[model samples]
Target: MMKVLLTGGAGYIGSHVAVSLAAAGHDIVCFDNLSNSRAAVIEHVEAITGQPVPLVVGDIRDRDAVRGAITDHGANAVIHFAGLKAVGESVADPMKYYDNNVRGTLSLIEAMVDCDVRTLVFSSSATVYGEPQYLPLDEAHPTAVTNPYGRTKLMIEEMLSDIAAADPAWRIAVLRYFNPVGAHDSGLIGEDPNGVPNNLMPFISRVAAGRLPELAVFGDDYATPDGTGVRDYIHVDDLAEGHVAALDRIRAQDDALSVWNLGTGQGYSVLDMISAFERINNVRVPHRVGPRRPGDVASCYASPDRARDELGWEAKRDLDAMCASTWRFERTAAMRNA
Candidate 1:
């Protein structure tokens, strides 16, 4: 069994990936700073996975700490999910974005090199595609990041490619994820964004939970069926599974440093998502149409053919499942807060 080091393993996606990797029988060692996550998540992850989360509570910027985790755990690979993520927040604090996202990644790579652990699975984003040139964005689409957060993602993708080129010993999986919603089926461990959530699903959840006043339907004048932006929403479980599939590929020596999009290849408009959330929770969400936010695109979804063909991964959960799982998590968030 391989001992895998997962950076940001305490966050939403990393926690899910930790459980997924553990379920696949790989020993997990998580390295995290807990900036946007809670220590309690580790307990809940243990509850869901039926195993303890062996974690190294530290920042990715700390090279010595990263090297220690790699050497101490003998990690065969690292699935990196640690970084600043909010688009608006990134725009406001580009220096923090560069420091943590870009510089921190460089430090991690340095530590990995020193520790002789070359395998990596990076958490890229659809934001790299920026304004979609066309519907169902494929891997070949033109790349442009509209926000600083997206720039960090794009920069890392390029950096990984360069590092792999310099030394083929680096086995990397760059998974450009689409809209990730929903929670684990257990309803115990889920996304708990501290303050205001920048993404769609959590905002909806907060509104449904009565924590927020109303949902701001950004850009209701977009050229879509419902006059709203469209995105390909993928289940967190499927994305987690995709990471496992990527690890399998990396371990099996089939392909290294390959990139794939993790999505369902199905586009859902904002109104469609709201309707589905309402149907699943049996609650009417109060919302108002607002002007298009800066850097907001008209449509952006994924073409999942590459992930299906290459990694043998496909998003199996539908919109209903995504909404249902999110509502379940939302219902318990109050208890978690207290």
Candidate 2:
């Protein structure tokens, strides 16, 4: 087992990944600024794994803090999840996205190099592919991001590629996630975005739980079978397991940089997801047809062939499983917050 430092480790995806890493017998040091997360998430992780993962309260842009955390923990690898993620927010404030995502990643890389820690698993988004050139986006798809959030991910990918090219010792795995939904089966932790959620699943959950009044079905005029947008929503646990697989692959291979898409080879329309949530949870989700958001696409999913072949990782959970687990967590979170 290796000592790992997870930046933004208390957030939704990071928290789940931490649990998986700890369960896999890795010692973890969770570093985050708590910008979009909470300290309580660490407690949930510890509860799930029965391990007290150390928490470091600092931003990734703080080179000194990041370096200290890595050196102090004797971390040999890093999983980067610290960044601004909302596409709409990034579109409104491009500089914030560049500074937090791009500049912060640069700082993290510098610290890793200084400490001679090269193995890294970066959290990337499929939005880097922009409007899909074709269905079932493969890694070979040309990258042309639309919003500032995606641009930051693309920029970081390019930078990491360059860094790895210069140093053969560096090993980097860029996992481009499609649409990550659902929660752990234990219902102890789940997606808890601050303010209004930007993603579809969480918004649907909130509407079901009565936290939000109604769900906004963005544009039912798309060319999809159901007219609403379609996306490949992978379970959070499956996505976390993929990270564990990636860490193992990076450790065993001599490759400098590897990229994989973490997704199931299937797409579900917006109505499909809403219907699943309502049917599985037996709840009514009031929704209305809204105008399409500027950067919204008709459909997006992943091929998952490369990830399956290379990293021996493929998303296993289905859409019904995703909706069921999310509803479970949504109810639990509501009770806890109450």
Candidate 3:
């Protein structure tokens, strides 16, 4: 079994990927600071995978600790996912985002180089293709990040590409993910945001649980079928599988750098998602109209052709599955707190 080091394996997407990688027979060591995640995530991952996910509680910025973790775990590859992701917070504190996201990645890459772990699968975002000029954005779309979060992702993509160019031995896979929602099927693990969530599904779940007052529907005046911002909301499980597929592709290649869009090749507006969640969860999500935030796009979806052809990965879960799994997670979270 190949050893893999997951930078943020305790977080939402990272835990799911850790489970997936373990199921595929890979030894994983998660390196995280626990700044945005819970320590109980290890139990959830073990319960799901039926194996312990070795923990290395440390920050990616700690070059010595990161290098030691790689050596101790005997990691042959690194999946970098440790980064601050709140868009609003990034705007409010761009330097914090830059230091944590950009500098963290650079430090991780440097540690990987020191540890001789050249294989890497970076967690990128579709926000790099800001304000889509086209309907279905391909990998060729222009990257114009309007937010600090998006800028961090775009800048890292450039850094990875340049690194690969300099070193021929590095086999890198940059997976530009779409809006990843939902949770694992078992409901043992899912997103556990520290405070009020900034994402759409989490907000909706909170509203259903009475934790939040109401869902603030941001701008129904956008030019779309339902007059709401449309986005490619891929299931978190599918997104996790995409990471596995990317690793598989990276292992097969002798010396090559690859990038693919991880998405379902479909678009759903804010209203569409709310309706789908309501139908699946059987709960009324109270919401109110709100002003449109700046840098908000009308619509953005992935083509997924590159991922299909390159990595042989396709998002299998539908909207219903996404909603059901997410609700299951919410139920579990409520029970745990109780």
Candidate 4:
């Protein structure tokens, strides 16, 4: 098993990936700043895996701390998930996004080079695709990000490409995730975004749990089948498994930079998702039609062919499972918080 250092490992996707890696018998060191996540998540991860994951509390931008964590843990690989992710927030403060996302990645890469650990699995987003030039976005789709959040992902992808080109020893996997939803089946941890959530599934969860009054169905006039925006929402566990698959593939390769989309290749409209949540959970989600936010797309999903054919991985969970798991987590988290 590989010794992997997970940056932002206490966060939603990071924590799930940590659990997956630990379950697969990998030694995991969780490094996080705790800026947007809680330290208690590490406890949940340990509880789920029945294995203690060492926590290194530090910022990714701190080169010394990053290097120390890598060297101290004897980490053979790094999974980068530390960054600002909100598109609206990124637009409001572009500098913050660039500094944390771009500069932070630079620091981590420098530390990796210093420690001679080259294998990397980067947490990228479909936002890098920007306004989808076509449906079922493939890795070959031209990248033209709309917001600063997306721009940072695109910039990091480019940076990794350049680094790989310069040094043949670097092995990188840029997993462009479409729309990651759901939580672990244990319902021990899930998406716990600070303040209001920017994504759809969490918002629906909150509304269903009565933490929020209602959901906002943005842009009902879009040209989708239901006139609402559509997205490919994959289960977080499935996405985490994709990371494990990526780590295995990258470890086997000598020198390669691979890009794959982790998604279901199926699009579900906003109303469709809400209906699924309500039907599955037997809860009413009061929602109203709202104006389309800036930089919002009508429909966005993934091709998922390359990841399937190459990495021997495909999303196995369906939409109903995603909704039910998220609602379960939301209720569990709410009770714990209470």
Provide C-alpha RMSD values for all models, in order. 1.2, 0.9, 1.0, 0.9
Q: Show where candidate 1 strays beyond 4 Å.
A: none
CA lDDT, every model vs. true structure: 0.89, 0.93, 0.90, 0.94
Instruction: Supply the TM-score for candidate 2.
Output: 0.98
Please estimate how well model 2 matches the true structure, expressed as its whole-model Cα lDDT.
Answer: 0.93
Better of 2 and 3 by lDDT: 2
TM-score of each: 0.97, 0.98, 0.98, 0.98
Report the lDDT tens digits of candidate 2 across residue range 74-160.
999999999999887888889999999999999999999999999999999999999999988999999999888999999999999
Stretches > 4 Å off in candidate 3: none
For candidate 1, write residues 156-229 as lDDT tens digits: 99999999988988889999999899999988767778788888998988898888999998888888888998
Residues 290-323, candidate 3: write the lDDT tens digits. 9887667889899999999888889999999989
Backbone atom clashes (below 3 Å) for every candidate: 0, 0, 0, 0
Give me the overall lDDT of model 1.
0.89
Tens-place lDDT per residue, model 4, 1-338, is 99999999999999999999988889999999998899999999999999888999999999999999999999999999999998888989999999999999999999999999999999999999998989889999999999899999999999999999999899999999989999999999999888899888999999888889999887899989989999999999999999999999998987679999999999999999999999999999999998987777889999999999989999999988998999999989988989
- Candidate 4's TM-score reads 0.98
1 against 4, candidate with superior lDDT: 4
Deviation of model 3 at 223, angstroms: 1.4
